[model samples]
Target: MKKAVILLSGGLDSTTCMGIAQNEGYELYPISFDYKQRHRKELEAAKKIAEYYNVKEHRIISLDNVGGSALTDKNIDVPEYKGDGEIPVTYVPARNILFLSYALGYAEVIGAEAIFIGVSSVDYSGYPDCRPEFIEAFQKVVDVGTAAGVKGKSIKIIAPLINLSKAETIKLGTKYGVPYHLTTSCYNGKEKACGVCDSCVLRLKGFAEAGIEDPIEYEK
Candidate 1:
């Protein structure tokens, strides 16, 4: 059986991608980051998703000290961009790179050849880390840095949602039987989702565009 590492964020996209991995019959290693985000509740969601899927292993690595962006800093504000003209304040600095690096390390340790992340460039909030170029660059890094790569084993960075729009992601999630109720995509750490944040807005739009009502409740 092929081993695969999935960057499970407990968000709709990641959970959907997890379904893809499971469907592929990959021995799953689901990894989530505890990166001091304001929405720590999402990590709890991640845990539930991991447990629900019965993955081979689940790891929650801490990135608390890697602070700077709005996600890591309590003082920083998450921006509500009506539309993207640039990267939103919610864009965590080097987030994808940091995530992939850790996933790479975990993959190496666990003898996995592929790492999956749920990054969408289309219909996105404009994070540079979500781009195909970034993933390609990181793939190069993975190929060169690992013992498996040096021994003719190539590491693949899988971004199943990279080219999909938010609506398309939602459609695929539905198609794959993803547990949307278990996913959370709010920027607030409160009891309910603040439906005004960029993430909440996008998620709401996704469900709407998919012609489906969201299972999760929001604090409008």
Candidate 2:
């Protein structure tokens, strides 16, 4: 059986990726982060998703250092952008890099051949880590940073949604039986999704494009 580690963020995309991994018959080990982000409910949502799928294991790691970035800091506001070139205040510095490194480390420990991430380019333009080049660069880094790679074994970074639009991702998730209702994508740590945040906006747009009514309620 091919084992894999999925970086699940409890968002629409990552939850979809979990379904994708299960569909591909990979024994899944889902990993979530408790990186002091403003929206901590997503971590709880991630646990629910894992239980729904019966993932082999679920791990949560903390990214300490509440310095800079709107996510970790309580003062900085998470800007609701007008969908332009700005990266926004919600960009956590080196977050993806930290998460990927931990995923790689866990993958090496368990001899997992691949690590799956849910990053996409079509819907998320603000995050640089979601780009294909970033994944490619990280793949190279993983190759050099591990004993498995040193022994000529490949550690592939599997990003099944890198090229797909958020709408297409939703379609795929639906096909794969992903429980969209179990996911959370809000940047605010609230009972319902604060629909104004970039994450919420993109998620709502995706559901709209997919022609499926989102199951979760949003605070408009």
Candidate 3:
């Protein structure tokens, strides 16, 4: 069976990627990160989603918190949704970069053909790393930096949700029967999602647009 490494953040987007990858017939190897993030509940959510897929193995990587962003720094507060052009405080410093690097390494180790990340440019929280130029540049990095690339068998860095809006992503995931109930998108790390945070707001908005009820409880 063809294998793929999925970067599972236990959020809507990442869980959707899991569904897409499963639909594509790849043997799933989900990899989640524990970077001491403020929203650590997502880690537990990741476990549930992985189990829902019945993957061969779910790898959880524990990374040290690089404390510049609100996601990692306790001193900083998670702000409400701001659709402004500037990068938000929740943007983990080079988060996707670090995540992709780790996924690249794991992909090579497992002889996986591709790495799946669920990042969407549309309906996102103003994170610069989620943009196309960044993914393209990182593809270049993979092409030059990895043995797989040097051997001309480059591990493809795939972001299937790049062009899709959150509602579109939700619709697609629903088509694949993704267990959205198993995923969590709260940045507050509370048991009940803080509906006002950027992530929860985006999630709720997407479910609304998709004409789907958000399955999780929210502390509005």
Candidate 4:
């Protein structure tokens, strides 16, 4: 069986990516991060998702000291649905870069062929790290920095939802039988999703556009 590392955030997209990776016949190694975000809900959700998939290895790394963005710093507020064009304060500084770096290291250590991240340029918060250009650049970094890459084996960074809108991603995930109810997409990190926040808004919007009601509970 082929091995693949997935950066699973226990959120909508990353959970969907898990389904995608499984569909591709890769042995799943899902990794989540605890960056001292506002709430532990996401990490909790990640744990549940990993359990549901029955993955062999589910590693949760701590980045509590690496605080800067609104998600990691309580001083910064997680803003509500602002227009989607501007980069929000919630953008964790170099988050994806750090995440992919971790995933790359794990992949190399485990001899995995690919690392999957659920980053979509379309229908995403305007985080610069979520863009296609950044993913492309990170792929280069993986190619050059890893010992495997230098030794003629290159680890692939796969973003299956890069070009898809949130709605499209939801549709694809549904086709793959992804258990969306186990996922959380709230930046507020509440027990029930704070539906007004950017993350929740986009997720709700995607479900609406897909003509399917979201299975998760939301704060009224």
Candidate 5:
């Protein structure tokens, strides 16, 4: 089986990516980051999702020094319900860059053929890092910088849900039997999801549009 490194965040999209990876018959090496984000509960959810998949490695790297966005710094407040066009305060600077960098290194070490990240351009939080152009640029970085790439074995960076809308993503995930209930999307970092936050709101909207009720609990 071909090996793939998946950046699993224990959120709706990332978990859906995990399902997609499995469906594609890859030996999953799921990686989660502990970047001092407000929603640390997602880490626990990541663990559960990894367990569900029975992956051999579920590496959780600590990135406590990486702070700037509201998600990472407690001093910053997580803004509620910003429209999709405006890049919100929650956009962690260079987060996807840092994440893909780590995944690229790990893929080289493990001889993995692909790296999967679940970043959607449509129905997203206006994070610039989640854009296709950024992913394309980072793919070039992997090709030029990695030993595997120099050896003519370039690891593919796959964003399977990049162009899909949130509802479309949910539909695909449902077809793959993604366990959405095990994931968390609230930026509020509480035990229950604050449904009003952008993440939660998008997730709810997706599930609603997909004609499936979200299994996770949300605060009233």
Candidate 6:
């Protein structure tokens, strides 16, 4: 079987990507980051999701805790959902860039054919990195920067949920039997989701729109 490295954050979207990639017949190599963020719940969720898929190896990369983002820094509190189009405080500086770089290196080493990220342009917080333009630019970087790319065999960077709305993504994941119960989308990182942070709010809205009950508990 072919191999694919999935950027699994143990959230709703990334877990969906696991289902999608598994359905696509790739041997899963899920990669996660342990960047000393405020919450450890997502990391724990990632591990559970990986085990659910029975992946041979799950890499949790330890990254130095970078400040400037509410998600990573304890000083910056995670804000409640604001539907304004402006990028939120939760936007981590150069997060996806750094993550995909590490994933690229891992894919090259493991000879994986694709890297899966579950970033949606629709129904999301206004993070610049979650947009299609960023994915396209990163794909260009992968196309030109990697040795495998120069050799005419580039690892594909797949964002299966880029164009889909949150509801649509939830529907897709449901079809693939993704274990949504094991996922986490609470930016606050508490065991019980705050249900107010942008992450939790979006997830709740998605499930509501999808006409499915969110399996996780919330501290509303």
Alpha-carbon deviation at 26 in model 1, angstroms: 1.0
Top-lDDT structure, candidate number: 6
Candidate 5: tens digits of C-alpha lDDT, residues 42-70:
99999999999999999999886577788
Instruction: Name the weakest run of 10 consecutive residues (lDDT summed) in model 6.
Output: 65-74
Error of 2 at 67 (Å): 2.6
True lDDT of residue 81, candidate 2: 45
Q: Stretches of candidate 1 above 4 Å error? A: none
Error of 2 at 42 (Å): 0.5
Residue 196 lDDT (model 2): 85
lDDT of 4: 0.91
Q: lDDT by residue for model 2 over 121-218, one digit each (tens)?
A: 88884788889999999999888878888899978999999999889999999999999999988888689888988888898899999999999998
**Higher-TM-score candidate of 2 and 3:** 3
Q: Model 5, poorest ten-residue lDDT window?
A: 64-73
RMSD of 4: 1.0
Model 3 poorest ten-residue lDDT run: 80-89
lDDT of candidate 3 over 11-111, digit per residue (tens): 99999999999999999999999999976789999999999999999999999988999899989988988787778888898899999999999999999
TM-score for every candidate vs. truth?
Answer: 0.95, 0.96, 0.98, 0.97, 0.97, 0.99
lDDT of 6: 0.95
lDDT by residue (1-220, candidate 1, tens digit) is 9989999998988998898888887888999988878767889999999988988689999886566778778798876647745777777888888888888888888889789899988877888889899998888887788887888897899999999989999998888788999999888757888899878988999899999899998889
Error of 3 at 148 (Å): 1.1
> Which sections of candidate 3 miss by over 4 Å?
none
Error of 1 at 24 (Å): 1.4
Clashes of each: 0, 0, 0, 0, 0, 0
Error of 4 at 54 (Å): 0.6
